[model samples]
Every structure is written in structure tokens, then in C-alpha cells.
Target: MSVTRVELAGRSYEVRVGSGLLEDVAVQCGPLLRKQAVPIITDANVAAYWQEAVTGSLTAAGFEPHFLVLDPGEATKSWQVLEQVVDWLLDQEVERGDHILALGGGVIGDLTGFAAAILKRGCGFIQLPTTLLAQVDSSVGGKTAINTRAGKNLVGAFHQPSLVLADLDALATLPSREMGAGYAEVIKYGILGDHAFFAWCEENGAKVVAGDAAAQEYAVDQSVAAKARIVAQDERETTGTRALLNLGHTFGHALEAETGFSDRLLHGEAVALGMVLAARFSARKGYISQDDAARICAAIGNALLTTEIASLDLSCRGADLVAHMLHDKKMDAGTLPFILLRGIGEAFVDKHVDLAEVGAFLDEELAR
Candidate 1:
């Protein structure tokens, strides 16, 4: 097992990446298991696949773990579901001292973390991210949020987890499409920074998706380590350091809005295509060479991810997509900062982008 520590200003936590960690949760969580009955939050899908291992582990460790299983997916990240989760946690009488475990993918992690943030003016929660996307991206960062009708992740908080148990074994059951979506996030790490890591991914991403143990571990570790370093520097995203992580998110969120945040375009897949747009857009602005943009698109295509927005059959024009982005959570005083690449592994926050130009660019992209 390899452990990566996220050092924040006043608090720090460890991200433990390995196989069968969920089977040893009691030992890994240590004193956080203050009560015999530990409250957990998961989705129905995850419960179907992993409930036995997780519940049985706690039962054997002398802890009676109770769970609140939610309907899986982005819809669960809503006011209605958030209210349900909070009510369930209250019924369980979760205390600030006791840690609530989030045992599922990104949706579960985000919803549970948000609940922990607002519960009794903030309680503690641990992340047991079962999916590759959650393990590498969302689980490490303290950014917890739910979706509002206005936009994705518009309602949320910055609540750090007590610990992150990324049990690689859990990924063995993931569908190939879900695994491909997760790989988009792994590619984001390299696209935003670490050129060498990007090259490594280009070579070994297939192996990682194929469930090669060493490749999986290395991809998760490197992605988490990159995130750990960035989070340590800007835990709250007050500085620009952490914003770099949004390499493809700004465009991706717009794509998600177009799809009504449905499974039609999973967040990771949207990101895959979004990175392609960012690359091409950067090229349009003369920031990067055309070859760099092509290479970016090629890498995404090599991973079997979407490189063309036209394929998704979005119902709106480019201007409509821009309208959705205007509602983004990252909007600062009516100025939205877009993360664009100068080249592979070199991403910068561009605040001077013209919305009119962006709208026109999306129009061109849509007509393609």
C-alpha cells in the first residue's frame, strides 16, 4: 500500500491507494471509528456490488455499520436528495466527532461530503471512492458540491475528508464505458501538467483500463500526488494554483448542461471532448501550434474517448452552451476564467477571454 498525504493549512489527511483496503477499513480508519455503528452513505449501484465486503468488514471489526443508499448518478446531487441524505444522517444522530463514510463513486462522494459539510455546522467524513474518476480526482480535493438546476456543482462547500481509502480492487467490477470515462480524468492530469506522465499514459492507459495492477497503481498514485501538491498550495482555491485542475471542466460542464447532466455524456467523457475543444480553442487563439492541438485530440482518440462534440447531438447552438457557462460556479464578478493550454502539460488560467469570441468559437465547433 502506498500513502500520499495532503497537507493543508491547519489539517492534513492521507490518501491510501491499494487493493482490498475496504476489507480492512476498521484498521485503516483507526480511532475515527468511535462508535460501534458507523454511518455510511452510498448509492444503490455501489451497494449492489460492494455492500457485502464493506458491511461484513465492519461487522467483523466489532462495528455495526449502517448505510443510507441513494439512487445513483448526477440527479442524486440535487436539493431533494441532499435533503434526504441530511435527514438520514440526522436520524442516525451523526456527531461531529464521528466520521461518516462515503462509499461509492463521485456522486456519492460529493453528496456525502456536502452533507458532512453542512451537518451540524460541519462534521467529519471519510471518502471510500470506488471509481477511477473519484479515486484520482474528486476524492482528494476538499471541493464537495451538488448540482443545482442553474448549473453543475453550483451548490456545494469546501469540506475535506478525514481519510481517502481508494481501494483499487473496487474498480475490477466497473463497466468498460465507466472505466473509459475515468481515464479522461487521468489524461487531464497529464494535459494540465506533467508532460512525462502524459506520455506514460499515452503508452499505458489501455493497460490501466485493462486492470493491470501496476499500471493502475501508478496512474492513480501519480494523479493523486499531482492533486495533493496542488491542493496543499491552494486548499480553498483562493490562488490560481488549484484552478489549473479545471483544465477541461469549464467546457465539460457546459456539455453536461446541454445533456441535462444525464448518462448520455458522462462527466469524464464530456471532459475528454472538452479538453479537445480547449486544445483547439487554444490553437484558434494562436497560443499553441496546430500540431499540439492535433496531438491532444489524437491522444484522446487513442484512449477511445470522444474528440468531436458533433457526435453528441447537442440540441443547442454554441451561444446556448456559452449561456450555460455563464452560470458556472467559477464565475467571478461576471468574468469567467477559462483554463486553456499553451502546450501539453502547460495549462494557464485565461481571464481575458472574450465571451463573444468564445460563443462564436463554440458556434464553429458545433457546426463541425
Candidate 2:
């Protein structure tokens, strides 16, 4: 087991990553097991694979496990579900001193965390992320939110988890397509700031995707560590440092909105394609060379992710994509700051972006 510490302004938490972590979750979280019965929120899909082990572990520890399982999908991250979770937690009589366990993928984590954030003015929560995307990215940085009609993650809070348990064994049940989407976020760490890690991914990304234990642990550790360092410095995103973490989020979120936030485009898939678009757009702006742009796409392709926007078959035009982007949470002073790359492993937030120019770029991309 490998543990990484995420230090924030007034508090810190450990992100525990390894195999069999779920089976021993009770022991790992024993100190925080304040009540005899622990309340957890999960999606049905994850419960099918992991609920038994998790419940068994807690049972062995003399802790009763209560579960509120929702239907599995991005659609669950809505205001409707958020209310249901909060109401259920209240019915369970969850107190602020109690920590709720979020035991599923990104959707579960985001909804549960957001619920905890607003429940009784804020409560503690633990993240038991099952998907690679959640384990590496969403589960860590304390950023939690539910999607709104406006855009993705527009309504949320920066509520850090009391603890994060990323059980690598959970990946064994993930379909290949899901694993590929998760790899997009793993590669983001490299593309944004760590060139060496990106190179390492080029050589070993396939191994991680294939369920190689060592590779999985290393990638999770590295990705979580990178996010920890950044979150520690800018917990509230007061500085531009934390925004760099949204390397491909701007374009990805637009794609998500265009697709109705459905399974048509998984979040990680959108991010993978978004990174490619960010790189290509950077090249268009003369920030990076064509070769570097090609390199980014090549790496994404190698990870078995879609690199072309044309493949999604969206009926929307570039103007439509830009329209969705106008709802992005990153907009500042009516200007959307885009994270662009100067080269491989070098990403910076550019606030000088012109929406009309971005729309023109998207128009050209759609043509190809």
C-alpha cells in the first residue's frame, strides 16, 4: 500500500492507493468510525462489484454499513439526486461530526461530496473511488460538484475528503473502454507539467490499462501527488496555479455539454480529445510547434483514446460548442481563460483568448 498526503491550508488527508484496500477499509478508517452504523452512497454498478467486500470488511469491524445506491450514470449528478442524497443522509440522522463514505466513481463522489458540503452547513466525507478517473483526479483535489443545465461542475464546492481510499483492485472489473477514458486523466499529469512522467506513460500506459498492479499504483501515486502539491498551494484557486490542473477541461466540458453529458462521450474521453484540441489550438496560436501537437495526439492515440473531434458525430457547429463553453465555470471577467501548451509537459492558463477566434478554430477542427 502506498499513501500520499494532501496538505491544505488548515488540514491534510491521506490518499491510500493499493490492492485489497477495500477489503481492509474498516481497519484503515477505524479511527473515524464514530458510529456503529456507517452511511455510504454508491451507484448500483459499483455495488454489484464491491459492496460485498466493503460491507464484509465493515461487518468484521463491528460496524454496520448502510448504503444508498443510485442508478449508475452521469445523469445522476443532478439537483434532483443531490436532494435525494441529502434527504437520505438526514433520514439516517447523519451529523456533522460523522463522515459519509462515497463508494463509487466520479459521479458518486461528486454528488456525495457536494451533499456533505451543504448538509448541515458541511460535514466530513471519505472518497472510495472505484474508477480510474475518480481515483486519480476527481477523488483527490477536494473539488466536488453536481452538473447543471448551464454546464459541467458549475454548482459545487471545494470540500476536501477526510480520507481517500483508491483501491487498485477495483480496476479489474472495469471494461477496457472505461480504463482508456481514465488513462486520459493519468496522461494529463504528464501533459500539464511532468514531461518525464508523460514519457513514462508512453512506455507503460498500456501496462496500467491492462491491470498491471505496479504500473497502476505508480500512476495513481504520481497523479495524486501532483494534484496534492497544487491543491496545497492554492486550495481555493485564488492563484492561477490550481487552474492549470484544468488542462483540457475547457474544451472537454463543452463536448460534454454538447453530448448532453451522457455515455455518448465519457468524461475522460472528452478530456483526451480536449487535450489534443488544446495542443492543436496552441499550435494554431503559435505557442507550440506542429510536431509537439502531433506528439500530444500520438500519446492520446497510444492510450486507446479518441483524438479526433470529428468522430463524435455531434450535430452542433463550432458556434454551438463555443456556446456551451460560455457556461464553463472558469470564465473570469467575461473572458474564458484557456489552458494552452507551449510544448509537451508545459501548460499555462491564457486569459487573453478571444471567443470568436476559438469559435473559428473549432469550425476548422469540425471541418476535419
Candidate 3:
């Protein structure tokens, strides 16, 4: 097991990455779980695959496991489901001292963490992220949120998890498409901060998605470590240091909205294409070379992810897409900050971005 610590002052937590961690979940989380009844929130898709292992672990440890299995999808992260989860947690008689387990992918982790955050003003929650995207990005950041009509993750809080167990065994059950989706976030870490890691990903991404155990562990561990270092520096995203983590999210969220946030574009797939757009946009702005931008796109394409907005077949124009971005959570003082690349692994926040120019750029991309 590789343990990466998110070193937040007075509230630091460890993210443990390894195989068979789920089977040993009770032992892994035994210290934080204070009561007999262990509450786990998961989506139906995940429950079908992982519920037994988690249940067995907790039960064997003399703890009664209670699962609130929800319908899986992006739509699950909503006010309605949030209300259901909060009400369920209340019925579980959970306390601030006790830790609630978020046992599934990013959706489960985000919803459960948000529920724990607002429960009795504040409570503890552990992240058992079953998906690669969650393990590498969402699960570690403490950025708990639910999508609102206004925009994605517009209504959310920075509620850190007590611990995170990223069990590799869960990846074994993931479909190839889901695995590719997860790889987008995995590569995002490399693209945003570490050039060497980006090169490594370029070489090993296929193996990682193909369920190569060593490659998956390295990718997860490296990605978690990269995120942990940043989170420790700016736990609340106050400094621009942490904003680099949004390297592809701004563009990705807009694509998500354009697609109705459905299966048509998975969050990771949106992000994959978003990074491509960001890179190309960066090149257009003279921040990065065209060759470098092409390299970035090539790496994304190598992972079998969508690398072009034109391929999405949206009826909207560039201006329409930018209209969706106006609702982005990162909007400030009527300006949206973009994470543009200076080069591979060199991302910085550009707050003075012109939305009109962005619309024009999208127009070109849409036409292409």
C-alpha cells in the first residue's frame, strides 16, 4: 500500500492506494469509526460489485453495515438526492465524531461528503473511491459538491474526508470506457504539474487502462501525491497554487452542460477534450507552441479519449458554449479564471481572460 498524506494543518488525512484495501476496509477505517452501525453511501452500480466485500469486512469486525444505495449517474448529485442522503444520515443517528463512509465513485464521495459536511453543522466522512477519477482528483481535494441548474459544482463546500482508501481491486470491474474516463484525471495531474510524469503517462497510459496492476498503482500513487502536495499548500483554493488543479475543468464543465450532463459525455471524457481545448487555446494565445499542443492532443488520443469538440456533434455555436461557461463556479468579479498552459506541466491561472475571444476560439473549434 502506498500512503499519501494531504497535510492540512490540524486536519490532515491519508490517502491509501493499494489492492485488496476494500476487503480490509474495516481494519483500514477501524480507528475513525466510533460506533457499531457503519453507514455507507454508494450508487447502485457500485453496490452491485463492491457491497459484499465491504459488508463482509465491517460485519466480520463486529460492525453492522447500513448502505443507502442510490441510482448511479451525474444526476444523482442534486438537491433531491442530497436531501435523501441527509435525511438517511439523520435516521442513522450519526454524530460529528463518527465517520460516515462514502463507498463508491466521485458521485458517492461528493454527495456523502457534502451530507457529512452539513450534517449537524459538521461531521466526519471517509472516502472509498471506487473510480479512478475519484481516486486521483475528487476524492483527495475535499471539494464536495452537487451539480445545480446554475452550473456544475456551483453549490458545494470544502469538506475534507477523514481518510481515503483507493482500492485497486475495484478497477477490475470497471468497463473500458470508464477506465479511459478515469485515465483523463490521472493524466491531468501529469499535464498540469509534472512534465516527467506526463511523459511517463504517454508511455504507460495503455497499460494503466488495460488493468496492469503496477501501472495503476504508480499512476494512482503519483497522482495522489501530486494532489496531496497542492492541497496541503492551499486546502481551500485560496491561493492560485491550488487552482492549477482546474486545468481542464472549466472547459470540461461547459461541454458537460452542452451535452446535458449525460452519458453522452462522461465527466472524464469532457475533461479529456477540455484539456485538448485548453492546450490548443494556449497555443493560440502564444503561451505554448502549436507542436506542444499537438503533442498534448496526441497523448489524450492515445488513451482512446475524445480530443475534439467538433466530434461531439453539438448544435450550439461557440457563443452558445461560452454562454454555458458564464455559469462556471470559478466566475469572479464578472470574470472567469482559466487554467491555461504555458507548456506541458506548466499550468497557471489566467483571470483576465476575455470571454468574447473565448467565444471566437470556440467558434473556430466548432467549425473544425
Q: What is the Å distance of residue 189 in model 2 from its true position?
A: 0.6
Question: Which regions in candidate 1 have their CA more than 4 angstroms from the true location?
Answer: none
Root-mean-square deviation (CA) per prediction: 0.9, 0.8, 0.7
Error of 3 at 9 (Å): 0.7
Candidate 2 has what TM-score? 0.99
Q: Lowest-scoring 10 consecutive residues by lDDT in candidate 3?
A: 326-335
RMSD of 1: 0.9
lDDT over C-alpha atoms for residue 265 of model 3: 96
Model 2 per-residue lDDT tens digits across residues 114-207: 9999999999999999999999999998899999989899999989999999999999999998999999999999999999999999899988
Q: Which ten residues in a row have the lowest lDDT in candidate 1?
A: 25-34
Report, for all candidates in order, the number of backbone clashes: 0, 0, 0
Q: How well does model 3 score by local distance difference test?
A: 0.93
Candidate 2 Cα misplacement greater than 4 A, ranges: none
For candidate 3, write residues 88-133 as lDDT tens digits. 9999999989999999888889999999999999999999999988
Residue pairs that clash (backbone atoms under 3 angstroms), model 3:
none
Q: How do all models score by TM-score?
A: 0.99, 0.99, 0.99
